[model samples]
Structure formats: structure tokens, C-alpha cells
Target: MTFFRAFCIERSAPATREALCGRFLSLDETALDAGDVLIRVECSSVNFKDALAATGRGKVVRRFPCVGGIDLAGTVLRSAAPRFAPGEKVIATGYELGVAHHGGYAERALLPGGWLLPLPASLSSQESMAIGTAGLTAAMAITRMEENGLKPERGPVLVTGASGGVGTLAIDMLAGRGYEVVALTAKAEQADWLRGLGASRVMLRSELPLDAFKPLDKGIWAGVIDNLGGATLAWALSTSKPTGVVASIGLAADSHLSASMMPFVLRGVSLLGIDSVYAGFSVRERAWARLAADLRPRHLASIMRIIPFEALPQVFGEFIAARATGRTVVQIARSGETEDMT
Candidate 1:
């Protein structure tokens, strides 16, 4: 195709304070950024970062007029890179996608082959996008924590931002691995749903005085997969057991961290910052393999929703408002193209 539709995020001219503008535009194939692989995008997923960039809510977009979807799965159409060839199913995420570089939100994406991975055989395009960057981050976090001596029998693992995509997937993965998964969320209403996703206990954020963090609270958590930063992160650290591993994934709440060093110095708690973007190929491959096998979320069908590509603009608000749940996969393949990617 010479031209295709893409939801592009553009900057609104030169302003004192730059504002991002996002819209659907028909873009020429030549307009795409240079890359070795050309992919016919079948599916993409909306992430918290996508919402921030598309809506201009957060300072996420590093470059202007970029197509915005951090995670994409599709069939490759052309390749200059020796590792990939035409007609192979593949997935791409992170590494400047949706922010600095043109990303998935288009019918076709031209990206460096090094930024892509063979789509796991067990995961279809739809299912892969359903997992997307969020699931990948969760899997990476779990893998990192486990490598740091976190085990199912260590103790309970706390997942902050529990109603969101990463938190939900982490809960499912942790519980499936026989760990006691405790979900911490502001939405008390989703307690039962979180439980269904394998959260052994649901802790409401309102119950905790996040700002009133003690230097050392009763050591409760053996591991923590923290999505929200700021006070929530501080509380998690302060309450962690000796040598507990905390994987800091996202800064949805606030970026600044203010807490006593008691958790780290006194108890030897380990805080691991998960950088899914710019992660080396070997690390991602190992995580993806586990994602397809044991770390794969068991309640995916129950928590995921497939939406038509046109409906993409409508859901950004839900994410910006912190009302989004689980995962939302965008079906990007046009009509007449195979919709049953699974």
C-alpha cells in the first residue's frame, strides 16, 4: 500500500510551552522512518504511555508527528535485515517506539529488525498484542525478582497499581506460580475481579497512609512489582521484608521518591528498576519465551478486550483518567484481512 491511516502525534507549532496534537491521518509509506523491516501491522495495544503521548497529558513524546502505539504484532512484508524475512510473524515494542520514533498505530510500520522478535509460536498476533508491552514489563519484573532470590515460598508479593494492565498481569503470573499475590489499587470496586485474576488479597490504596511512611514497618512483602512510584513505592519499600526484591516498573503515581533508607540499609531490600525499553535482545527473548510458557497470564481472555482500530481515539481518556483495566488490543488489520489472528 502506498498510503495508510495512522494516528499521529504532532506538536502544535512552536509555542512557549509545547503542546502535542494527535489525530488520524493518511500517511505515505515513504513518510515512515527508516528501518530494515516493513511490517503489515495486524494488532496493537494501548498502554499508559500511549495514552499520555496521544492525549498530551504527560511529557512522553520525544519527537513530533509520530505514530503512537508502543506494542505491535504483525506479519513482516519486507526485510533488509538478515535475521528476518518476508511473511514471518513478529512483534516489536519499546526502544523509542511511540515516543521518539514512529510506532505501531498504523496499518504498516517500518522499524529496525533489531527492534523486533519472532512472535512466539503459541501466541497469535492478537494474543501477542493482548500481552503487549505491559505483559512484557510484568514478565521482566518477575524474572528479575526471581533472579534476585524471590520465590513463591519467600512470602507475599505486592503489586501496586493493581487494577491496571501491568498489575493485573503480574498478579496472574505470580499467583499462577504459587506465590501469595496481594493487589494494591485505588479502585476498591475491582476487588473481586482482582481476586479472580489470582490476587490472594486485595488492598485498597485508601486504607494506607502513603505519605506517613514509617522508617521500617512490619516486614510484610517478600517481593513487590511496583507500577506506581512516589509514596506508594516508598510505602512498599518501608514495609518490605529483609532482602525483599522490589521491581520498580512505572511512575504512574509520581516520580519523586522520598523514604528512609531503613528498608535498603537495615533490611537489605533490593529495589530493581525495570527498563523494558532499550533492553538487550537476549533479555527480551528469554522474557518472551517465559511469557509464552509459564509466565503467560492465565486470565487473559477474561481481562482483555479487542477493539476496532477506529475506536482507538476514544479509549485514551479512560487511561488518562486512570479508569482503564487489564488490556485493550486494537485490531489493525483491515476488513477482508484475517481478523482471527489467534
Candidate 2:
């Protein structure tokens, strides 16, 4: 019967254009949505989507007074679900979290039994939050690419927006899989850091421009994991080698793609849309398994910044401005300790 503090956004009027005023409030367990498992949230990571939801910029928040964190890693405090028990470690991301449902910004969370995944043996709760939804999206993109015949022997793989969380993880995971990875970043200062994260080469976004609406360009990449979805994705599609697959994960840029169909019709290129939120449980389990095994980033800790929960508002602003790099994890509870739910 313990109460906790949480951040909430309340919108008074529903208009096509509206503003959200967020504040910290006290909440009890009864305030959380009904669920079979109660988790004492240890860490919750900040993602670009979380930023959008927090700011009310991109229709990410469907309801008022909602908590906004898409990814949470914690210890189970109580569970009616047979798969999970008290003291078990778990992580939850995607599947309507931080959107239509109340999310993980609080010290506590009540999530559906099926939405919870047992923490992988190799990852700690902090490490899992560091990976978060951004890392999972990267893993899903890589898994999709591999399933579509991407191989280390083919040629170089390109990761667009390579300094962001998903982009950084994609670079690390692809390089870990033995692919020669080329990182494309808008920030020139992060070139050395990207290189240290196993990137074979780093290029500025200005260096790779889509000057013309050409149907196709010189074939360079064996595959591409594109987080920037505007002209950058269009250029990747036009320039990828024949039979190459391009996985579109995020839309940091504009979502609309204005390009010719000649790349697909003439070059046999494939554009794969990656939606991590609605992915099936089996698929998510396999993705997490792969992340625990082959896809875990070697220098994962280097890219993570741990912050207190109170700093989330400012962090959200930085994320929305595209200034924050790597993973921003919010520490809600002490490490290796389970809360009493009973």
C-alpha cells in the first residue's frame, strides 16, 4: 500500500491544435491500470517517440494525464501470471505502452501479463533499459535484413542518422555481425565516436545528398538500415545495390517519400517497413534473444547516460530538438533491489 510520484500531462480542451501542461503528481497503486503483474520500475529509457508524446507534437499521446515512457525494465513485485513471479526480472516495451495506455514514467507499473518478457540472462535491468525500444527497433531491422539475405560478404551496410539511439545501435549490431558498417550522421563532431562504436566509415548527411529525383544511382550498399525516412530513405532506395534490402525503422525526417518506382521495378530493391510496436510476442522474443546473443552492442555502456527521473522534462526537450545522442535512461529504483508489492 505504498504511493509513488509520477509525471503527468493534462489537456483540458480537445482541439486540432492544443497544448499540454505536464506536472509531477502523487499516485498510488490503485491509479495504475489493471494488470496481472506489478513491477517496481528500476529504469525507463527516453526515446524520440517519448519526446514527441511528452511535447504533444506528433499525436503520440492519445489521452490526457498519461505517463509517457515507451520502454521500462524492472523487477516483478507481484504477479498473478504463471510465467512471472515475485522477484523475477522483466522488461516491457511497445504494444500500446506509453501511448494509448498508462506507461512507465512512475516508480511502479501494472502491465499485462503477456506484455512482459523475462529479462535476458546476459542483460541487467539498466542494460536492458539502455537497449530499450530504440535498440529493439535496431535489432528488428537487422533481423529483417538478415532474413532477406543480407550477409557480411556482400558489401558495406549503411546506417542513416547514425548518431541517434536506433542508428547508433544499428551501427554497433551490424558491425558486431561482421558487416563493414558506414555511419551517416548529421553531426560531424560524433564521427570519431561513431568510429569507435565499430563503424568502418562515417559520413556526414550533407556528404550524401539527393540532388536529383533520379530513378537510380550508382549501386554502393549491400543493405541499408535507415532511421531517417525522408529524402535520405529515398536516396538509399535509389542507390542500393540490386537485390539489396532497406529497412525503414524511424521517421526522424519527414515521413513522406517522393521517389520514382524505377528503383524497385528496375533494380529489384526492397523497402521493408519495420513496426516494432505491433510485432507479435514470438517475434519480439526472438528479437530479444538475438539481441542477447549476437546483436548486443559491444560498447553499449559508452552510449548510455543515466539521469534521475526529475531531469526527464529537460531531457525530453533535448530529444525533441534532436540534440540528445545515444540512450537516456531514467533511474527510478536502486539497482538489484525488489520492491514489496503486497
List all candidate RMSDs to the true structure.
3.0, 2.3
Residue 32's lDDT within candidate 1 is 94
TM-score of each: 0.95, 0.95
Number of clashes found in candidate 1: 0
Candidate 2, position 78, lDDT = 88
Provide the lDDT at 284 for model 2: 91
lDDT (10s digit) by residue, model 2, range 1-342: 688877776664433222334567889988888799999888899998887777677778787778778899888888999999898989999987888777888888999999999999899988999998998999998888889999999999999999999988888998888999999999999999999998999989987766774678888999999988889999999989998999999889889888778889998888999999988899899999998998988888898999988877777778777899999889977555454555
CA lDDT of 330 in candidate 1?
Answer: 98
lDDT of 2 at 226: 91
- Candidate 1: C-alpha lDDT: 0.91
